[model samples]
Target: MAARRPARAAAANGEVRTGGSGRSDRRAELLRIAAGLFATRGYKQTTVRDIADEAGILSGSLYHHFSSKEEMLDEILRDFLGRLLERFTAIEEQGRDPKQVLDQLIEHSFATIHETPEAVALYQNESGALSGQPGFAYVDQLGRKIEEIWIRALTAGQKSGVFRDDVDAGMTYRFIRDTVWCAVRWYRPRGRFRHEAVAEQYLRVLYGGLVTE
Candidate 1:
């Protein structure tokens, strides 16, 4: 499921249609800039002035829409987590075999890494820090909830005799989790391997197994 960790990385960075025109569009653009900054730099370390400077605007202008830096962080994280949950929910509801669902989930994850590398990296770094902290509660909840989703998918496949039942679902999920998302550390959007191709290779190896069939 790879849900969003509550931080200042907004999914709106990926979803916002910026080539248009409006004040709302401008606000979205500002948020996107803030999200990227917050994701790259730690949210706590990023100041409202930093975001405003990045956007080439005054801090007061930045505050016109959002009350404070914390408020912006909250919006970004909420949007990111909310969108990720919706995506995983759709994947869950979509009629696919467990293997296929797992495939889509992994591929989508790579795409997410490609599209929102900063957010993915931010989640990787700050999830531990944000856990159980005030005003970042959804970060913890969404994480557990997303983990359950992945476990269910894996366990369901094992029960259906599609995947090998010998491996523990939790262990398998952790392996996949560590292997795939951690790639964001080295992956560049314009790097040698693209998200889709990397996903295909990973899937081929994952489903086919190391030993020859």
Candidate 2:
């Protein structure tokens, strides 16, 4: 089930008028559809008409929910990155051992790719193009914040003698981040391996080098 937002009560009849509720649901559905198109077609190449066509609604109806294609893209990315940063920040603030925090971060990342592959791909594909564009600055800002979380975790682990001291924390973070996120390109949600399994296997090799002595 889609996660439920807080319920709003109707004033007049004392009945829950879910008219606004239903519209919010439909709007979310439209955003999901748009994200997939933006991920695959490239954000610039996709038109509002394309998303409206896919949703079986007229472009005018789509405009009722979103003013423009850019609006849809903006909402999709903002929600994705905003929620991600929140979760990562919470994990960081927990002050657990660095390895535990890193473990959760990696696991959450794989689960996110499995659950929201379209958003992940959209961010990955369009971030560079949208880097300096107005109204898209949060993309880079939130991205750097996330990067800082991982780098901090790695640095902490190294200082505590948990992770290897020889590895550069920033370089190691990029290596892990790229390798894990790039899986979105080929990962099948219903494929042979579940995300937890993928995460575990990757973590095994990541924490323990591929050497048998």
Q: Report the number of the highest-lDDT candidate.
A: 2
TM-score of 2: 0.90
* Deviation in Å, model 1, residue 78 alpha carbon: 1.3
Q: Using Cα atoms with residue i matched to residue i, what is each candidate's TM-score against the true structure?
A: 0.84, 0.90
Q: Over the full model, what C-alpha lDDT does candidate 1 score relative to the true structure?
A: 0.78
Q: Whose TM-score is greatest here?
A: 2
How far in Å is the alpha carbon of 123 misplaced in model 2?
Answer: 0.4
Error of 2 at 54 (Å): 0.6
- Listed per model in order, the count of residue pairs whose N, CA or C atoms clash below 3 Å is 0, 0
C-alpha lDDT values of all predictions: 0.78, 0.85
How well is each residue in 71-177 modelled by candidate 2, as lDDT tens digits?
Answer: 77777887788889889989889867999999999999999999999999999999999999987787888899899999999999999998889979999999999
Model 2: lowest-lDDT 10 consecutive positions: 1-10
* Candidate 1: clashing residue pairs, number: 0
